[model samples]
Target: MTTAVPEDALVLAGGGHSHALVLRRWAMHPERRPRRPVILVNRHSTALYSGMVPGLIAGIYQRRDAAIDLRRLAARAGVALVIAEITGVDSTGKRLELSQRPPLRFGLLSLDVGAETRPSGGMPIKPLEPALAFLEAEDLEKPAGDAAPFCVVGSGLAAVEVVLALRHRWPERSLRLQAFPKRLEARVLQVLKRHRIELQPADAPLPGPSLHCTGSRAPSWLQATGLPLDQNGRLLTDHHLQVEGETLIFASGDCAVIRSDPRPASGVWAVRSARPLAANLEARCRGGSTRPWRPQRQALQLLGIPGSAPQALALKGHWRLGPFRWLWWWKQRIDRRFMAGFQQLQTMDSIDPDASMACRGCAAKLAASPLTAALAESGLRSAAQQPEDAAELLPAGTAGSSWLQSVDGFPALLSDPWRNARLTALHACSDLWASGAMVTSAQAVITVPALSSPLQSELLRQTLAGLQSALEPQGAALIGGHTLEARHPTPAPASLGMQVTLCVNGQVRRKHTGTGWSKRGLRHGDRLLLSRPLGTGVLFAAAMQGAADAEDLDRAERMMGSSQHPLLEELLREETEQEELHACTDITGFGLLGHLGEMLDDDCRLQLDAVKIPSLNGALELLEAGHCSSLAPANRSAWRWLDAPAGKAGPRIHLNLEGLPIGGSRHRALLELLVDPQTCGPLLIGCSETLAMRLESLHSWHRIGCVL
Candidate 1:
């Protein structure tokens, strides 16, 4: 979320080339950016650079070389990155309707969503992601000799590049191109013949897997917006890239056509329009006049040749050049230089030294000291006093059954609303799982961003769906809930402005013996087991700074979204009945050390093998680089409770770090991770050493320490 004062929100509806370049420009020149919340909505976290897509397909470039990391770009530009499919636009309402989330309201909007290619009988290649997936799948499913002939349909640069790429990928496979002879230049046809690709009429029947690059047309969803479109179904815009007769709306890239000075839909024009489009959008946001953008009538196009040696054809208007090796080298240089701008981000310094970037997720929670102080001041029972993950409901239910309830939530840690809600649900249910309770029912208090009526309804609908998805598997029902709007709304890619708190009810059965596990009984020599790795706090904190790797973030999210039910079931299996769980609690906002302190008895001490502690990938590296959750400092205060002097206010829970060299990088990282707050973190279980060994063999749990 942005700290900028509430103002008109500017929404860039797509991660097209123009928008990506615009974001890069804004990152470089912050002063030129409008002082408003800027949001970029797209279907994926990365955008394929169209210019290098041909190279990528031909194996001249890797996927990473051709794809732009929108997450990092948005972070650098201070823009909210929303990864969601856009369904339609409410032009009159100035809102973008999304597929799974609410409509995004905007004071100013820009459409660089690119164009679509309708395929008559083959795969459409307009949307690069799906096409790439298709190629990869085909390659895996069909071996070289068994594969059918490859075909490309179209009479444009995209089709030509694809056909050549196919030849490079499978040299022995027969390749065919279906294109109108009138649309192709004589020289181009000659090159196709030289490459041994059969050229047929545009209406020729396709064989095997056909790749359709049949030019560009506006996405069908745009027609529902009631925007003025040219004959080809592209949004008609004036010279300044603004929709005709609409001040707040703007359009560029293949999805739009300039009415007065029309240019063919191409990546060249998209790249060229970036500067003007960005300037115009900023001007509109500032309530200033927009400048007209006059693009060159002809653009230089470099066509790659599929061969052992690198070669390319340069075309501009009526002028053409040979498939020279120098041209390919030049093209590679240009593409790399263009991509480098995004790779090397400018270092950002805080404008206010007093303010620091606070970590999101559970790390955003109130510190332990103030929270305990407040609870004491309000005459409420603290976690230390209760020593249970959930509160027990009064009176027994049918038979000897009792009830347990817990509520847990936090600000959005992820940009995807559905996934965020899923993570939140799993976190809320963790309390019940810790107490060996089966979740029965839950009620949610959902606070969404202030938006139009339709948007609010949509947001709530998606949120509830996410909640139901998580609870359904556990035999839990969503009985009732309340909804409200945030007092101050900020632009999010999806539901960052939304916060969900679930009051979960669970049932715990007693077999006429005793209650379920609580955080009070830790026998001496009992082993401490951690269900999962630590460092979600540090990873997410690094993500906000664009310092986290994409793979690491994806892994972390997968871990967070995984339910703890399976682990709970394994622990409660009859085979493990001989070994009892003595104490249990889920590590949450408070770091592991902070939460573990509650489970300690006055005479108990913990001897931990620092080397045995598992950490999420890159978490330690990030911590070593001075990145840590904002709550780490406050959570460190828990150390004072450990080994406190005699007569001091102490539970006397001393912590001894084993196998750790003091003042070393690894040691420092481990210490910070111990205090790093976690959202949907692991469960700390106290059990016998034999039980820990048995469980570790059965699951991924690690034995971190032993009670003394």
Candidate 2:
């Protein structure tokens, strides 16, 4: 359910350590949360723990170990998560300008977006995501035996760890550390020498690829906000962590410095400031006073040494500890314990006990049983009578042309408004495409969430833009549409409360005498081909429970957003004219079995190769773990219609599992996937073996079964 955004919503901009901890606190202690809606805006779905960066760089930890799933955290905390790059902040207007969507207005705002590193000649080590990507790409391109010296520039512990990490990642490559002699501690210098890393003057010219761990500075975009800044351009905040002279704005982490007790930019300070930041943000939201935060002057820093037998060094203002193996273990424990705070959150499920989590997208459609019953009672032709994807609109005396029309929609599936609308447009167009017609025009009926007039307008703008993007690419014009506000807003993230419905019109070219492709023309021995993989249903269901992997969700979103025009074009290519496609339909709210049931003939039964069914990555595992779309049970009813003899109903479809393992976890999972409703799912086409083979050779289409 989507939560309505009030006029006084609190926005936390950036998923830095401090903001992440604030969310954790709210998750663990919901009673102490702010009264108003809390939203977290970040550029990515995962936040990297800075404390674990060295270990991650040295290959001591997996990427998941160091990354926090912001989506899960926000869901657990009852906060909305918006994944988008923040381009600028408007202090006077109380708005945050985003790169892709419209500007977001906030009643109270907090900034924990860590500082940016601007290196003169090398990649900046801050903003670890892109930096890590660059490093990985460089490693892949450069041979292991390359003698080129990789350089790290800085005298800080971060630079030293990065240099050592390079040594660990590429053992044969020459590694160089550029730091001033006066800035380096004796023990640190000794560790560098022991690792065979050459130390050069800070000003030394780098001969190869280099990384800069130079200290933090405010992001250039923040400068446009006209906020108070310190010597290094970091935001200036009061003792209470509130932006100086601004009561409604707060700042923390490396991005801001408390003017009363300034400290060096470090992850330690970021962690230490979380508790106080959370308290102050909550206090400000409830119309209460905030307390001042006084941080300790010195923080203990632990630096890990990467080698066969790892050790760590601890440092304070003037005190230094030994590089012992115990220290390394201790550091690992701290990092793991910190990460466990997020990982362990999986135990705290947010799903309501009394109500099942109704899915979004196509899975959210009304069940067929009730819809068919209602249509019959109203004396209207049911879908069974008109088994085609789109309705044929023939003008009274027109003999040369006929129009195909279809309307489809659902509540927003993704938090991003643009993406959700774009996918909706694609899903709506699939009907015409399934009928072997190209969309020529479309009209939309969009319902924006209940918000201020300005916010509603901004959301509508994004939705329209997304819809237009999908239509314009197919040479389809968006003629006109209607807009309204939702009566009751459900509580979820981003623009989940918004809904979109599109009515598409297309022209069908006659093949000899037939009007267009239909779903009823299946013959014996006709093979079934699927254009894309399945499992969007189960995957999204798992996502609502915070159990889906970020990578899997990312891959699923890419597939769902991709246009199916290329596949449609390929199927209708001139070379394939000799072999006709018997039937076709886009698998949607009705799962594969449900949609396939509609294509069956009285005497024919489909023989499916269970193992040949394509599923998205991690989908089978999710299914095996008992995650399924809410509509699966209703969709499973379609099994009754499968393999039935003429004038008779059979129990289920016949599976051609000759020697494969039976009743195994994977087998059951695959069976369940058949009834798992898809959102913008694949196109299922029936054709002869000759055409099937040709389509399968194209790589996108997979022949999953055949009518027997």
Candidate 3:
């Protein structure tokens, strides 16, 4: 692992099992960090070993336990980890095409990205992909609203495991299954034959000049590169394990199919390949000749559960080992140890140079979808008539009394309290605006961590300034507010917030509490139009972690700032019109989708134009890339109505919206002209088409997504 850091590149494009050991060796040796060699791993994270696939699928092991943490691993190995996906290599030019980073120029390269199963879906199944089915399975936290069937087209151990995992994940469902050129393995065929399972006899189908999955053969591109591949998709290589035609390019493990020393696509080959692969890389770096890779005649191969316990059919020679619990235990221990390297990384205060972060979630924040969904669900509700019959008919109480109030909160994730106060203030007045009231006064509700009194006061001053600035537009004054010192609260402070929230209560000059003006009284079928776009929930979460670009952050800030006042004035005008525009009142906390479901009327259903709905600058990209606000889960949990079948509306956005939004272009753009709840938030603006258009036409309409 130690040597002069060589600028001459040796690009290792995977973090497969063998490469991991190589990386670990590098990590422990500091020479590897500087000039050792450049290791280009495509996956930013780690890939799990195949042995733990069954346990992971069976829910016995957490995903962290099954997968390796490549980043942490590479870091420990003192190697630069380039987070990218490799498309292909121009070996002739010695350049590699990657999804991220510039096409790398390398002096020597070894690709063990591993083979994928038969291709499926728009996402290409990697050559000999292990999780082809499980990864593609629609174990959609919720049913896909319909029984959306997915396919797996392989007849190998990997394929069987995937199918069983899928079956287990969706216990009560009618799912279709399809396998081409079915019967595989001598043992499997014998069992199926005994159990009356059908199969097309080998060569009974037909012979063809062309290549197909019907025969075990490598695809054209891989074969054309001139790496050894049997007629099957397996990589063809020599006893030395050098991929054919390319001397420097060593292909081993599941990717290879040895000609002279034929071996099944099993761990034995990869494990055997590791010794030489490591030696080869080391020798190449040390300016020495590569060693020959010898494949074992037979080694252990374990089958994952199709319908079994902690059991496996082990392969060694012609003799098969018992499906013993002990074997499973041994396999479990090895896999667990590997995975533990990842999962247990942070606990080791003193970092090992070679261990990569094991948990993707260790540094990850909560998703945002559910957060918006929750707020949106509660933002609007019908109210029942609380009779205006005066409890005090006499003028003893000096006319109707009003209690000016404000409740302001910001997504606490933003570390600065002063900044949070500003955002929180903007959010608080939203309730006053939506309710068609003018703010009379506001106050600070202070909470602080254990700190010096001066620090507390300074914090209080900054917060009040932000609050005052935020509330001024609503014509509210910060009269007074309360504060407390606590470690945490039920609704955490702005530091952890996805979106800022605050409330300012304005007095109704013409108090109408007697009227059933509250949201609980509203009917269903009211078309749900948004005053703001649907990405603040995501944007807030993204901003909290500072994951967003400067433009995105600016857009988010502007969106929150602009959303206030504009909607408030609009609501105030509608209130004066004496025509009750809103049958209910609710702020958008859950999301446009979640809140829309709350007020559904029998004949009135929500119809939306996908493109018509506004989005924050990076919102669309965030949702697509699977970033969501932390609050998303709660929203989804509270509004199970989204689970119902309502045609396309059933699954609002068909994208991976369940997670927190990590703002990208759309979310940033949406934030530029959004009525997101963070700042003043937008009034729900429940009105007729004419009023909706009028609201949409206003310059301020851009602050909130246009009502129309």
lDDT of 2 at 332: 88
Q: In terms of TM-score, which candidate is stronger, 1 or 2?
A: 2
* lDDT by residue (tens digit), candidate 3, 113-198: 66554443333334323343434454543564345444433465555454445445544443332344544666654543332334
Positional deviation of 97 in candidate 3, in angstroms?
Answer: 2.7
Candidate 1 clashing pairs, residues 3+ apart or interchain: 82-493
Q: Which numbered prediction scores highest in lDDT against the true structure?
A: 2
lDDT of 1 by residue, 1-708 (tens): 011222456889999999999998887877777776677899878888887888788777888788788887876676777777899988777788988546777777899998888756678997888888888877775667678878889888778888888888877777899988888888788878888899988776777788898877888898888899987789999898989877678899999989999989888999999999998877776667778989999999899886888688999988999889999888888989988888787324422223236766788899978888777788875653655788878664434547789988888776555667878899999998898787899999999987766556655766787788788888899999888888973543335777999999987643333366788789998999999999899988887666777667767877998889778777767224567888889999888888888887767777777778889999999999999888999999876655567776543554455656778898788788888898889989999888888888898788888887
lDDT of each: 0.80, 0.83, 0.49
TM-score of 3: 0.45
**Candidate with the larger lDDT of 1 and 2:** 2
Indicate the residue-level lDDT of 316 in model 2. 94
Instruction: In model 3, state the lDDT of residue 136.
Output: 40
Q: Which runs of model 1 end up more than 4 angstroms from their true locations? A: 1-8, 141-148, 167-207, 245-247, 347-357, 365-382, 395-401, 407-426, 436-535, 554-584, 590-676, 682-708
Per-model TM-score versus the true fold: 0.76, 0.88, 0.45
